[model samples]
Target: MTINVIGIGLDGVVGLNESVRQIVERATVLVGSDRHLRYFPNHSAEIIVLEDILETIVEIRQHLDTPNSCIVVLTSGDPLFFGLGRLLVTHFPPEKLRFYPHLSSVQLAFSRLKIPWQDAKIISVHGRSMDELIQALQQGVEKIAVLTDHTHTPKAIASLLLALDLPIDYHFWVCENIGSEDERVQQWSIDEAKQEIFAPLNVVVLLRQSRIATNQSLDLANLPWLGIPDSYFCTYDDRPGLMTKREIRVLILAELGLQPGQIIWDIGAGSGSVSVEIARLFSDSTVYAIEKTAAGTSLIEENCRRFQTNNVVSIHGNAPDILHHLRPPHRIFIGGSSGKLRNILGVCGMRMLPGGIIVLAFTSLENLHTALSWVEERKKSDRSWNYRLLQVQLSRSIPIANLTRFTPLNPVNIMIISR
Candidate 1:
């Protein structure tokens, strides 16, 4: 007894062609939600409401022994995609189930907006947590499509995004009742989306705004002398939210132990968050902000200008290769190494001034291990060489309904080295 799982759209029965209509008409047992069953009111088939999925599956199994059962399970869009079809497939044999798919809400939403979805990261907050969406945003995915529910509405999503205060901005589109008569696809700023109400059946699409669009006027006087917000700096559009957090930056600054008229090197500067802060605090110090990527170097200059840190020299080239050309550093902060950790560390050790301090931050275990290994090798020759590792974890408060909860930033291992 084969189960025919037919995918329907908002248009319902009228949208079905002759072939699929015939399959539905011959059903001896029909299964679907109340809203879906209402579409075929006059059909002569034993009804099964899809309220409790487990109970419905049990009922369907009972009919398998009966003589020639034509079972038609109706669902919306592509049933296999975050739908009941996946559950059905798990219980039934592969040969017993057949899927007939229609355009998904995401598909319809993207079509309405006239954007390609091949590269879009699709996350369903429907009957699930918002963790996936949050992670995707943190990773700086260029495009995202969110399937929403009563709890995780478009408004709620916008609020969460705003609370994050990310380095990059997004163009938020609330696509409501996608294929229905009153369908609406409107773009709103993150602030505007938080205030507006959207239909229950909606998809939220986010496109990472261009670099130019993300630039906002800064009030330097109002900004803090230390702990500047991550959003203040101009970050990479393709890789937003990549800057060192304010808390981590403070920790790194303390680890460096800066002095007047000193030379500081910020290798893999990445927006020069730390470099700008150092330049601001010790105006007499010349901070060389070294970055490999052209985009990163440009951002360093922009952020330096915004913070009015004239002492931060944005050097656009790879580390170790470019480190030799610059003056030896009294202090160094290696935020990134671009997989050349050993080579960079060797050059820094050779060129570092006496009593110089080097602070390296690592988010991955592999990099942390590599740094430790390098230190161990160097310590074999010089017993005076020393290192201290600090595992730093920080979280910020975000509002969930009226209450607040903490979302942790990425854990960082800070290796402070000195001789």
Candidate 2:
């Protein structure tokens, strides 16, 4: 006996092609939700309402024992596209099941809007957590199609988007009753979506307005005095979390002991997070953010503009080689040394202004030892040179079901060297 999973749309029975319609007509048994079952009320098949899925599966097993039973399980949209087909495959053998997929709501949604969906990120919050949707938003994906449920409605998603205070903005589109007679596709502002009511069957689409953050709308006065949130700055597309996190940035900023009119060099600046923060704090200070990758340099410049930190000069070149062209620094931050920690340290140590402080952040023990060795070798030549180490470990709270749990960040060992 084979379980034929036929994909239906909001348009119901009339939407099925002749070939698929014949399969449904010859079925000896039928299983589906109340909505899906309503499409074929006059059918003579033995009906099973999918209220308790485990119980329904047991009934299906019993029906399978019959020698010549044809079981048809109805589902909405493409059965394999975040639908019931996955569950059926896990419980039954591949040979015992066949799938006839209709157009998915996401596909219908994009079609209604006349938007190409090949690159769109599809997320389903229907009877599931919104963790994936939240992560997609954080990443600032170009396009997204979200299948929502009663709890995670369009309005709720809009509210969550506004609350995130993201660097980028999205054009919110709600497609309701897609592929049905009463289908409605409308674009709404993030604020307007919060006050409106949408149909029960709806898909939320988010299209990023721009690739870069909207810096003109940024209210710098409202920003924190120190350690700006990581979300405010636009890092690399591939390496979003590569920049110095806020927790560690705070410690690095404190160790720098920043003062006005000081020259600061941020070596291996991933996205200029440290440079921008220092520039914002002390406008008189000049921050030279040296990054090797062109993409990294572009991101550093973009972040500088986003935060309106004009004092930050983004330099696209490797450190030590690039350090010689710049003015001697009163403070140095080594966020990344690019496997040349010794050379960077030698240049920084020799060129630094008297009483200048250098803070290096390391996640690897090997790099930490390299810096320690470099400092020890330098201490013999200069008695005033000395270093201190601080190991930082931090964790942030995250929701786990009804309770909260702590998720630890990467451990960092900070080496502070001063004369």
lDDT of 2 by residue, 218-265 (tens): 678998989787767786654455778898999999999998999999
Whole-model lDDT values for every prediction: 0.90, 0.88
User: Which ranges in model 2 have alpha carbons more than 4 Å from their true place?
Assistant: 220-225, 229-242, 299-310, 363-366, 379-384, 390-412
Give the per-residue lDDT of model 1 (tens digit) for 198-266.
898899999987653236777878888888878777887777778899899999999999989999999
> Compared to the true structure, candidate 1 yields what TM-score?
0.91
Task: Score every model by TM-score.
Answer: 0.91, 0.86
Best-fitting candidate, scored by TM-score: 1
Clashes of 2: 0
Best-fitting candidate, scored by lDDT: 1
The true-versus-predicted C-alpha distance at residue 198 of model 1, in Å, is 2.0
Alpha-carbon runs more than 4 Å astray in model 1? 212-214, 339-343, 364-386, 399-404
